[model samples]
Target: MQSFEIDKSDLLRIKNALEDNDAELQRVLLQYHTSEIAILFEKLQPDERERIINVLPTGEASEVIAEMDEEHHPAELLVNLTPEKRSEIVEELDYDDATDLLSQLDESDQQQILRDIDQEDASNIRALLNYDEDTAGGLMNTDLIKVNGKLNKNEALEEIIRQSEEMEEFYTLYAVNDDDILLGILSIKDIIKAKKEVTVLELVNKEFVYVKVDLDQEEVAKLISQYNLTSIPVVNDDMKLLGRITVDDIIDVMEEENTEDILKISGVSEDEELSGGWRNAVKSRLPWLVINLGTAFLAASVIRSYEDTAAKLPIISAYMIIIAGMGGNAATQALAVTVRRISLSDLTDRQAYITVVKEFLVGMTNGATNGVIVAAVANWYDSNPMLGLVMFLAMTGNLIIAGLTGATIPLILKRVGIDPAVASSIIITTFTDCIGFLLPLWLATKLLL
Candidate 1:
């Protein structure tokens, strides 16, 4: 197979062909895989994408839609197709994928699409849709191979063969009792090696990791990554098997959770779409900026209080910015590390204490090193050793404060049930800015004045 990049030229060629209704060019698109075709959808206009989707085979079109980004509104493309074509594509989608697409549409649209699918698939999709989209149940797929533990090895093998024929892949076969309660998981290797007369109960491994339906998807991904599992089973309150969440779904959850954290850390709303209109971007960002402005006023007030001292020694104005900027940078360093640690797991009292102490020491050491360098530069610039000494002391004090506050704020927020990522940055900025400006000005007032 050959690979080709879908560049502007290729998009232009496809666009021109579609505009002209070029039959030969349309046939060439059929040769590309569904994933490649999906990429083309992103570059093409909505009408062109709809035309191509309508022209493709139903199964291929369904796969192409599935391959597109959920945020791109792939469900809208399905709406453009005729009812018969829409029904065919919807029927071909995996239950989880179909449910995800439908959930993105309006309630009436969701119901209309659901009515087109088979009764059994519709019921399964409805059941999945009932769970929170960030929970284990929502991430799981109903397509899995299961066998009764009471069955003989040959019977189990036959059942597995029958069940997996429609599935693209299977990693492990789940063994359940008559009540459909999950008993154990059997690896494919073990099943293949079992004697013909052996029972599945004899071969199944009872020690297996699984998640409850309500478990958060982040925790689900953590469990899968921690245990090195390709797929983890989902169970109800009674321990009845519901479905399996594969590694692919876990990857998606990881990406989403990471994106949300990054946005929150920057004081931006996670719900803000990257490709959304400027209006939405402003709406999502304005509140945080307002809070930041208020904090800026507070920092400015600190400077206003020291105006007499600044006016007396005008050179102090220049040094004030240097000290405050360095302090803010140091605090941000500590904040980043602390936020990541909190995300990994809940810290014990001992761990939290250790974290604070470590950051404090780091702050002290780094502050001393940087303060000495800046102190030397100040003395050289102003030819005043006393001025150097004052800067050194002020920088050292501000950095220690920075380190302490940065390390503690996020942990404190976590304790109070607040999302550390959301508010920690603003609070740390205020602490660093106020202290950063106040220390040098106050010191210069007493020493240099």
Candidate 2:
């Protein structure tokens, strides 16, 4: 399908339709997909969004709300919806999506909404809500096609057809025992090719990969990507089938995880929303800035200790900033790579050591190349070979330090059970800054004095 891009004209048309109570509103919206409508909701006022939701069919409305980013306050919109309408929408949503929306509300709101939906659906949603949102259980949907392992080809096909009536789409069939323990998986192709006499257990792929419900969502995502699966079964400790996590859910998890890592690396709290207010912005960011300020003071003290060196040769001031900035930039690059690697998978001791060593070599190569250029510039600018030599040595040494710290700090933090992305950048910045300033000045004092 082609991607839809909403424009100013489209917004104006929608607003006009809303104001005039035009019947054209539904027709205009019908042109867009559910996801596209979700995007449009982000641009509309809450009341306008409510009007739009009320106009759409119940199923489509649920999909639009499910597609919406949490920053848009979908839970609040659900609360504003009339009880009967809210129940209709909730019932239409998949248990996973319904759980996510309801979990964002207060306990009372959740209970009230739960009371209105079908008992079975509400029970499924309640079971999902008990899981941590970052786990496999939270990402899985109870909706799936499963057959008893003893069922023959014809019986399995009949079961599938019966089970599939409530589902919009399915990619795989799970084979389970009478006790609901997962036996294996069967593809539609396998079932179609099987002889009438074959049982589901005989046709099932016993080696299929599956994840425990308590597994971290990141690990679940990795397994899905590694195996190139459209969906994977989720089970409990006893291998009892619970639900299946589809590729669509894994895609969302990957996006959320990568966004969270980027935010944490930038010293911003992951909880801070892009659409949040100024007060929330300050509340989320001020603590990190204060910590950074403390680190800056440490660098300043290093500079203070070399007061005489900088005073005697004021030219060192300009060159020092260049050295420090280069070191900080290089460290940041190394830190980004290391943190991303850690996120993708756990590293063994040997692998982690090799990573650090590889980064060290990279730092040396980059440092030597930049050092030569900077040294040439310094020599030409000041007409002093001694000053140039000092610049070369300081630049090379500081970058080496930058590389070592960048790669090593994250690994150490991760070992200590800390999130490498959260603490690595701040710590690496301090190291780069302090060493960046100390290196050039100390070298210049001894060599160029």
Candidate 3:
């Protein structure tokens, strides 16, 4: 297969073909993969994208739709196609993909799309649609290869071939009992290596990892990663296997979750949907800015209380900003690590305490090192050792405050049923800033005034 890169030149050729209704349009498009075509869709008008989907083979069109960034509203693009084309493309989609696409559409459109597909597909899509998009049920695909544990190796091999014919790929072969309860997972290698007389029950890995349908998708991803699994089975409360979540879907989930966490850490609302228009962008950000502004005043008030000292020692103004700024930066570093750790696993009370202590130690060592350096600079500049001493004490104190609050606030928020990633930054900043200012000024007042 030839490699291709979509660039300005490719975009220009595609656009000219689109504009002129050129005969070579389909031929030109066929050379690129659906994923590449989806990237092109981001630059084209919606009508042009709809036309491309209409012209492409149903299977390819479905992949294009699936591959389109969620920001482009692939659901809306499908709805724009003629009803027949829409139904055909949707029918070509897998149950999980179809469910995700339909869930993005309005209720009436979703129902219409669901109604248009085959009954079995519609039923599976509907079941998946009922799940919250953040859960295992929402992320799982009904398409999986399975065999009864009682089946002999030959029988299981036959069943696998029959079941896998339509699937693009499969990882593990799930073994189930007569009740459809997931007994365990079996490797395809184990099945192929087994003697013809051996039952699947004998080959099943009964200790395999699986998740309940209602489990959080992030937790599901962690399980797959920790166990080094390519796919994982999703079961109901009774342990009946409903579906499997593939590694591909987990990759998408991880990207989305990481993006959300990054935004939240920067004090943006997760609901902002970064894909939307200016109105949404402003609406998402304004409230947070206002809250940040409020915190700014609190920090300013600390400085106001020290106006007399600052006015007498004008040099202090320049260094005050550095002290507070360093404290905020240190707190942010701690916040990022703690938030990442929290996201990866549920920390035990002991682990949480250890994390706090570790951050405190880190803050102390870093603060002392940086503080001494700044102190040396201060002493050299003014030929006054007292100024240097005040700076060293203040930096060390503020950093300790930064480290403690950075570690503890997130854990406290998690215990209170709040998202640690969202609120921790703001709280940590307030603590660091107030102390960062207060500590240096108090030291100056007591030691130098």
Candidate 4:
């Protein structure tokens, strides 16, 4: 086969055929230029889109539909088809993509489509759907190419030929026993290189890794990343072969994991899909804002507790905020770094202790530098040497404590079996503000007031 040479003329011709409802031209484009045919399908009016979809072979349509924007994908194509047509379309889609498309629709519609699909395919899709969409099983395809352990290379090649005739996406062939217990895996490259007389069991690599169906998708991605596997087999805890998770699914899983962590650290729920509607966006953000409001008052209440001390020395209010802000930034930087380390498993043995000590040292240096600057500026602005000196002393102490608190809070949270990442921001912020407020007010009352 030669590489496709698509040009503007090709696109236009396909568009013209779609518009004119010329079945012959549509057939030609569908046969030779799937990409061009897809573009034409996308350009058609709703009814025209339905006509094109109805006419195209499901496999070609599925491959073309998979190329669409996630938010505007096969769901868009499905809405125009009958339930039976939708099932046929889904049955031809790669497993992960099929699950994703059905998941986008209303619950009732999704169920209807699934109920009408082939029983085996529907079962696989349902199983994938049952797993959290962010896990290994959820991201795996059901199109595994498996063979009995007894097959010789010749027999295995024959099996693969017949299987590949119907299934084209497989990478590795899982060699399993009669009971479906996994024995090993053999890559297609190995199959091609081997003597045809050899048994698949002899060709299979028993040392190959597999993921359990229930494993977290992030862990699956980490394994794939660490080993650079193109596809990996997934199994039940009992070692029964399930299916293979592809590189493409791992990429999506990695993206979803990254998105989930980013959102969680921002105090948003993991399920708040960023592509959702306005109601969803607002709903996801408001709870965090409200919790922050209450937490803000906790920081504020620290100041209220010291109001008497502050009133006697108004200069403290002006400089205290700056001191507090400086401490907040240092703590936040430390917290973010530590949280990422824990998330990525970059913090190794006793490294958390090293991190704590380094951050405290950093805090001490940071606090002293900022305190001197704040004190000097305050002294010049207020002409009160005592107020300036108090600001200097308080900020330095607050910043050091901020560093100690920042590093330890997450470690402590992890020790207590909490999600250190999710709770880190609130803990770091509240600590810095409260401690910054109190330390400064204490220094002010003792020295300036």
Candidate 5:
């Protein structure tokens, strides 16, 4: 067995193999990093990689192939394969992974793969593929143990053992009625604790809850956490057990959702990558950047309107920069906190509004306190009383605005079904900048000049 971590030279060798049309050597040469292997598959046109993928083991091979970024259509190669080969890959994939790949393929391609797969696999994939990618159904594993309530303790254990052989270590067993509605759940520990003589129907807990297939993954995660469930069953309209959302998968969903929100708060889109192509990356960000620019100009225009005040007291212009920075930073902090809360829980408009008022007060009191400190710092440097006063007023104003803007934007976005994080940076910064610049000049005009 040969395995080695690839370095620069290995990467070059893999590249050379693709150049030489050595698909055999290419597959063998590039088994080190799954992501890197995906990237290697990108070097050849899809037809070449498609040919290479055919020779590999189904599971590990499928993982490496799945590692390819969806942006690259080296998958076009996958689309051209025989329906049998396409399905061979699809059938071997886990429900979630298969759904991800299948959703990316064209309608006709998906149809062909579905037609070519086993009926059971096809049904499971279709059931999952039908749901939104963010929902529990899409993210959950359909291969879950479900026991009929009529089963006695011995019968249930036997059924669970048979299912375990099929799916392996299924921690949660859903107890369903004849109508297929979820009644409760049984854990592995619960099964083991039962007397061999006790009926499973008597042993299984009936208080456990479940979620619908269409429920958001975030919500599903909350349900699991709140109830302390190892796994939560997902059901369809008929209450037939469609799947179970496992904690491991829920953890992934939570990380993704939180990361997406964090990026959004920073005025970055989910697609912005540190290593993406310059053109693609810039295009993804440029629209929002341009929007941010427009708002910046709006801020500058406010400063422009008070240019005469700044002209009369050049100190106002100098201190305005500090104001803008303080406000923007404060607003970002508030926005991040609120956005994360909304993401994890059901935050009502009223609750958000109340939070806004509290943040405003918090922002104001803290801003005023920081303003006093900044004013003192500025006055210490310049030996001017008015400079200190200007710093204090501007800092207080900006902090107040930052807290309100940061908290409100995401909440509003949620209400509208837009990602709260989208354009959050641009919105919060624009508000803070506009306020930061204008407030100091306006205060200066009234008090200093």
Candidate 6:
């Protein structure tokens, strides 16, 4: 399919079609893919979105809703739909998409909507809702092709044909026992190339990677990425096949996880929507800002204790800001790298130790390089070798402190079960700032005072 972007002119045409109650609106919308329509919904008001959804066929509407970003509030859009239309759209959606939308609603709303859909679909959705939204079970769809492993190749093919009637597409077929215990997997090629009498069990690739139902979605993404899999089976504790998670779902999970990490690193809550109102923005961000302010005072207290030294040498105060700012920036660089590594996988004790040591050496080298430049500037300005020495010592010491705290704190937080991304920046900032201020002032007192 060709790529398409909804430019301003396209938006204007779409809006005009909606405004005029034009029958051509469907035609205009049909030109865009369902994903594009979903993007367009983000630009529309609630009522406008409702109108467009109402105008489309139920299956298309369902696809558009499924394609929407969660921040667009797809659940609210479903609620705004008329009950009969809502049920139709819900029924048209895949089990995973329908469950995700309903999970965002209140229990009463979810139940009411579930009652109106197919009993089997509702049951599958309820089963999925029981898992945390960030787990493999929640990410999987119950709609997939599976065949009895005891079946001969021809019988398995017939069974696949029967089961595939309900599914839109499938890349791999799961092999299960009579009790639904997952045995292995079969590619289409494996099935087609085998003799008619060959059993599915004989053809199945038994050594396949799979995830438990409760496995974290991030880990699921990692496994899928590591193995370059198109899909992975989800199983219960007893290895009973529950559902399968497709590559598309993993792609979404990866995007969500990456966005969350980026936001947390910047000290913003992941819940803050990019297009959210100021009130919501404040609600999401104010707490972190308050916490940062509290930490800022700790750095202030360090400066306060050295008031005499700073007062005696006013030039020391100016250099102090430079050192602290540089330290904070350098520490942030280390913290970002460390947090990214931790997120990708749990490091062994040896790996973690090596990581800290690596940052320490990096800090030392960078600190010395920057120190010489600052020391030279200080000597040139004050014509005092002692002041330059103090500056050099302060810069090098604080940077070393920066690297250590930045690398070590995240690993410690991870070990203690804290989200290193959320807490690391705050703690590292406090360390770098306090040490940045204290190092220069104390050195100045000893060497220059």
Number of colliding residue pairs in model 2 = 0
Among these predictions, the greatest lDDT belongs to 2
Pairs in steric clash, model 4? none
Residue range 421-444, candidate 5, lDDT tens digits: 675677788888889888888888
Worst 10 residues of 1 by lDDT: 19-28
Model 5 alpha-carbon drift over 4 Å, by segment: 1-52, 66-77, 80-84, 192-197, 271-275, 348-354, 365-369, 412-419
| lDDT, each prediction | 0.89, 0.93, 0.90, 0.79, 0.77, 0.92
Off by over 4 Å in 4: 1-80, 103-108, 275-277, 346-349, 383-386
RMSD of 1: 2.0
Model 5 scores a TM of 0.83
Q: TM-scores for all candidates? A: 0.95, 0.98, 0.96, 0.82, 0.83, 0.97
Candidate order by lDDT, decreasing, is: 2, 6, 3, 1, 4, 5
Tell me each candidate's RMSD, in Å, in order. Answer: 2.0, 1.0, 1.9, 5.0, 4.1, 1.4
Which ranges in model 6 have alpha carbons more than 4 Å from their true place? 1-6
lDDT of 2 by residue, 204-278 (tens): 889999999999999999999999999999999999999999999999999999999999999999999989999
Measured by TM-score, the strongest candidate is 2
For model 3, how does the per-residue alpha-carbon lDDT over 140-206 read when each residue is reduced to its tens digit? 9999998999999999999999998889889899999999999999899999898999999999988
Choose 1 or 2, whichever is better by lDDT.
2
Which tens-of-lDDT digit does each residue in 111-216 have in candidate 1? 9888987888889889989988889988888889989999998899899899988787889899999999999999878888989899999998999999999999
For model 3, the run of ten residues with the poorest summed lDDT: 16-25
Q: What's each prediction's clash count?
A: 0, 0, 0, 0, 3, 0
Instruction: Pick out the ten consecutive residues of candidate 2 with the lowest summed lDDT.
Output: 16-25
Assess candidate 5 and give its lDDT: 0.77
Q: What is the lDDT of residue 129 in candidate 4?
A: 83
